[model samples]
Target: MSEFGQVLRGAFGPARVFEQRPLAPLTTFRVGGPADYLLETRSSDEIVDALELAGRHGVPVTLLGGGSNVLVSDAGVRGLVIRPRGGAIFELDEQHVRADAAVTINGLVRWTVLHGLGGLERWAGTPGTVGGATFGNAHFTGQLIGELVTGVHLVTRQGHECDVPVADMHFGYDRSRLQDTGEILLWATFRVERGDSDALRSTARASLAYRKRTQPLDLPSAGCVFRNPEPGRDVVPDGIPWSAGALIDRAGLKGTASGGARVSTVHGNFIVNEGGATAADIRALIDRCRSEVRRQFGVELREEIVCLGDAPVISRS
Candidate 1:
């Protein structure tokens, strides 16, 4: 073990921290290199402790949630990578539900539905965790997840834990204050209402069915590759649908390939790994998809996925 590894073990125990840990298995895409130091945090205390320790050591820190909407570079990540594994849920009252950041969206939805909690029942098939959804203000059926977030618990970049109400979140399409503040989400409390379990289950089933039909869930993918073009900012051409996938399809770019990566025929927006796909291949395909959309429709499709490792989280180029 290196000096830093020994220090990390002293603070967090040897089993809690890993060196050159392969990250591909941790992500939905099942592709990526390794993290120089990967710490599995089981509690908020561990999270802040690791952050403070790494900060003092001058090592960069990156937080990896339930890796759904991300593309990791083949070169791997530098410094410390923290993956919080805390999973706890609570019904604070008749109107609120608090979930640990690591709780999967599907798990939360199921838990709510079982308990007859209605507000989140409609989001049954959403990918990633509560933290990821809150971070990105995840959207579905014209609704943003942040709209239901009543409050959030996060550890700031300075390694201090704080709870902020929804009013301060600055939730917008594919964004939240966490994006700007660089805070690590630990838990989120959401608004809820009592409802019939049967009704909620019906809705949940419908959502799962819709995703199964429209999304390329069979292959390895990072979900939608690009955000749909915003109105006024990017005018949609006549006869073309306003969705990102539609634009890519209209551009005749579906099934487009770069190495093992290919734009899914089921959904033009998803780039799936057929087999032996590299992060570089996925990235090249993303670039091609954007260029083709721009050339054909004069609309530049923005990325919705996060890219990790020696690059900006979201690649504009």
Candidate 2:
């Protein structure tokens, strides 16, 4: 460990920090090597301070939420991993809901239902945190996070805190400008409408059931692998009306394996980490499917899962 690590240890202590801790246990996929330094923050203020310290010390930092939609390298991350825990800050108001960046999307959906709010129920089973969902512009029922978000509070890489109106956020299909701009989301306020509690619960339950039935929710995997491209009004064979998953499925890539990673048998778009899978295996499978899809259908699939760090490459063919 370096002298900077020693100083961080003195400031944060052993309980909140770890040296060379395995990230596999922290993520849903159960794949990845250790992070050089790990910091589990309990509040946004703590996050801001940690970011500032790491920035000043010239150490790279990666923010981890639920760790649902990422694939980390086997060689491990070179710098610090900051994990934030959201609690009562995700509470609801009369016509709006506030969620800390670390709050799970599923938990937020449940909160909306409990508070008699509508709009987020369609995303009942999403596997990431509110910040990840917003960063990715996640959508269900033709509704994206941008539509519900009223405001976002974030700390920039330079350690300045600011509130951004949702209207100012540039949101596209499965992509957010905030990601390119490098803003660390702290929390968000979402505007919602009143609805019957029982009705909201029923809607959420139905959406959850549908997702569980279609997606391989029992396994360790990121939600989706590719963004659905736009299609012309004509629903022809060359049109992009169908999703990338359907395209991969039609290409006969479902249940295909490269090392320990497999295109999910239930859903072709989800690449699963079978027991003892490595990051290289996932990357290989992603490449294989992308290659085959392009060769067979002429449609290029764009990755939705965020890849972090560099590792040894694996060959699928």
Candidate 3:
């Protein structure tokens, strides 16, 4: 074993650390290269230890959750990739629930509904972990995940664990303070309301059905590709409104292809992998959408999907 491997084993034990782990399989998009070191952490202590070790070794660290909103580079990520496996959930009261960051958003939504809790049913079909959703302030329709969040438990880059309240999160469209801070979200507490279980379930079913009809769920995609442009912007072409999907569709980029990546015919905002897709291919498709949208509507669309490793190549003209 190499000296670094020996050090990792000593710090995290032999069972927790892996070498040269392929990252593609870890993501919903199923595209990425590999991580030089991958660490599976199930608790806050483990995560802090892994981060500390990475710092001591002068190696960068990347945090991966449910892997639904990210695109990993074809060249892979350097340093350690920490995948948190904690999935604990607790009911704090009749109107509150606490969930670990690693808990799936669907699982949390279902649990809340099963317990007759309201406020998260709109996210019934959402993919990815609570952490990923919270980081991006995931939204459906006009309801955002940040709205239900009361507080979050996070680990900072300096290895300090802290509790952050909702007001400090800076929640906005597809954004949160976590995006810039690189803090690891450990868990979150949400404020819910008691509702009729049957009614909540019905609402969840309706929302999920709408998603199924509108989204290309059968194919592999990292959810929406771009954030909708702000309303009333002059850059929005006349009659374009402010929908990202509508913008892409109007740009005539729907179903456009680059290698195995193609814009979804059902939802212009999604770029689906038609099997054998690479990160580069998806990047190319994203660039095409951005460039075409800018060309046709004079609006610069921003990406909602997060890219890891190498930065995306934006097209000019």
Question: For each candidate, what TM-score against the reference?
Answer: 0.96, 0.93, 0.94
Tell me which of candidates 2 and 3 scores higher on lDDT: 3
Ranking by lDDT: 1, 3, 2
Candidate 1 deviant stretches above 4 angstroms: 311-317
Q: Look at candidate 1 and tell me the lDDT of residue 10.
A: 92
lDDT of every predicted structure (CA atoms): 0.89, 0.82, 0.88
Off-target runs (Cα >4 Å) in candidate 2 are 90-93, 232-236, 239-241
| Candidate 2 weakest ten by summed lDDT | 232-241
lDDT of 3 by residue, 1-317 (tens): 65666788898788988888899999989999888888888876888888888888888899898889999998788888889886888999988899998888989989999998998887889999998999999999888889899999999987999999889999987889999999989899999999999999999999999999999999889999899888664367677768889999998989899888899999999999999989988988888888888887789989899998754444222
Extract clashing residue pairs from model 3: none
Predicted candidate 1 versus true structure: per-residue lDDT over 179-246, tens digit per residue:
89899988999899999999999999998898898999999998998999888778999999889999
| Best model per TM-score | 1
Compare candidates 2 and 3 on TM-score and give the better one.
Answer: 3
**Model 3 ranges off by over 4 Å:** 232-234, 311-317
Report the lDDT of model 3 for residue 251: 88
The TM-score, computed over Cα atoms with residue i paired to residue i, of candidate 2 is 0.93
**lDDT of model 2 at residue 51?**
90
